[model samples]
Target: MSLFHFSIRIKSSRLCLLNIKVYFCFALAICLLGIKAEVRANDRYEIVINTGVSEKALSVNSLRSIFSMHLKTWSDGTKIRVFVFSDDDQLHQNFSKEKLNVFPYQLRSTWDRLVYSGTGQAPIKVNSTEEMLTKVATTPGAIGYLWRADINEKVNVLEIK
Candidate 1:
């Protein structure tokens, strides 16, 4: 009877340890999920360009010129081609207002006029930052904007002042 009681006590202790471990694992999982959700919430924009781009820091005016097709090349002789996110995207609205100093609607109307008049082509609109980054990375002379968190080794970042 004594031996049996000892064995039962050991089993109960083991069960208690197992329960503690399970609770620890559950808590850890919840913490990790919270961290991931917070990371996803802090959205920021990035300026991405082709590998060969020379201009590292561009003024708002210069960026505007490049996107508006007023400037065609860098000082190093690389041709410039700009890409833009769709009008509905937050990045597009923020970039237009903050960097381009224009409202999203006004910018779209101006781009349309430029396209229709044959004066300049509108920047190619991409659906997402990931798509923009992939295309800009692969295509020579391509430049686009994306969320900063989405930037990766595939594309080079340019500073917009």
Candidate 2:
């Protein structure tokens, strides 16, 4: 082949490689941004309660007490019924750690102690997100945690201090 043609071919291949690099860099940047947003999504959970309850927010400690079944009644004298997912559930783990600053095992230990001691009761365990939403909606003064996306008009999102 002529030297001229050979040089042109080399240039074209170099251009193609450069294009691939640029494309990949753009893709990598987009992926990084998406990962940041996904992390925020992972943290998106809300403390929800039945609308009949008057309180709109709670301190983290009070929230912990409620979930641990030590706080049995809402301030308005409405019975505070607590709901939860099973200990092994991912949502349960996240909520326990992030919101309550406790592990699932710790919450479980507290609940078990409450139950066996006969002075208190454990929270109701819901099987799925749907069951959680339904129970919290139907039961007055009920409290539970749910992913923000699954939340609807049936319950009020309780703010945590």
Candidate 3:
């Protein structure tokens, strides 16, 4: 081939390789973002309660008892006000199923029944973990759960059994 044709071919090949590399990098970035999103989605949480209330470590049963009004007062006689995340939230769903050993729908139905019957009041619902933490911190006799990563100094995190 002539010199000019050979140079053109080299430049064209280099451009094609560069385009392929860019596309590959873009695809890799997208995959990494997707993986990060999924990890965030399934992030686990630790249950936390107010300080100086119960020396007894919390468990699913204890949590249920407190939430369902079976256990109205803490060991110290502090009336418990349970704070809960929204029923439709994914984190709430996972936490309920994994930690609470109950489904969101079941919890909702239970709350509804309690509200309707005037037997007990359901826990106050917060839209997000941050809000739950904030409300739990500011409000006395409050208890709630949130993602471990979402915890901050605003609230006291109680150890669960």
Highest lDDT against the true fold, candidate: 2
Error of 2 at 57 (Å): 1.0
Note each model's CA RMSD in angstroms.
Answer: 14.1, 9.8, 10.5
Mark the regions of model 1 whose C-alpha exceeds 4 Å error after superposition. Answer: 1-43
By lDDT, the better pick of 1 and 3 is 1
Ranked by lDDT, the better of candidates 1 and 2 is 2
Clashing pairs in 3: none
Model 3 over residues 46-123: C-alpha lDDT tens digits?
Answer: 676655454547766888777665677877787888888788777777777766777788888888898899988888
* Weakest 10 consecutive residues of candidate 2 by summed lDDT: 34-43
Cα lDDT tens digits, model 2, 100-149, are 87878888888888789897898888999999999999998899999999
Provide the lDDT at 135 for model 2. Answer: 98
Worst 10 residues of 3 by lDDT: 35-44
**Model 1: per-residue lDDT, tens digit, 49-158?**
88877678889888887876778888788778888888867777777766677777887887789889998788787877677988899878888887777888888888
Query: TM-score, each model?
Result: 0.68, 0.73, 0.67
Cα shift from native, residue 95, model 3 (Å):
1.2
Q: List where candidate 2 sits over 4 angstroms from the true fold.
A: 1-42
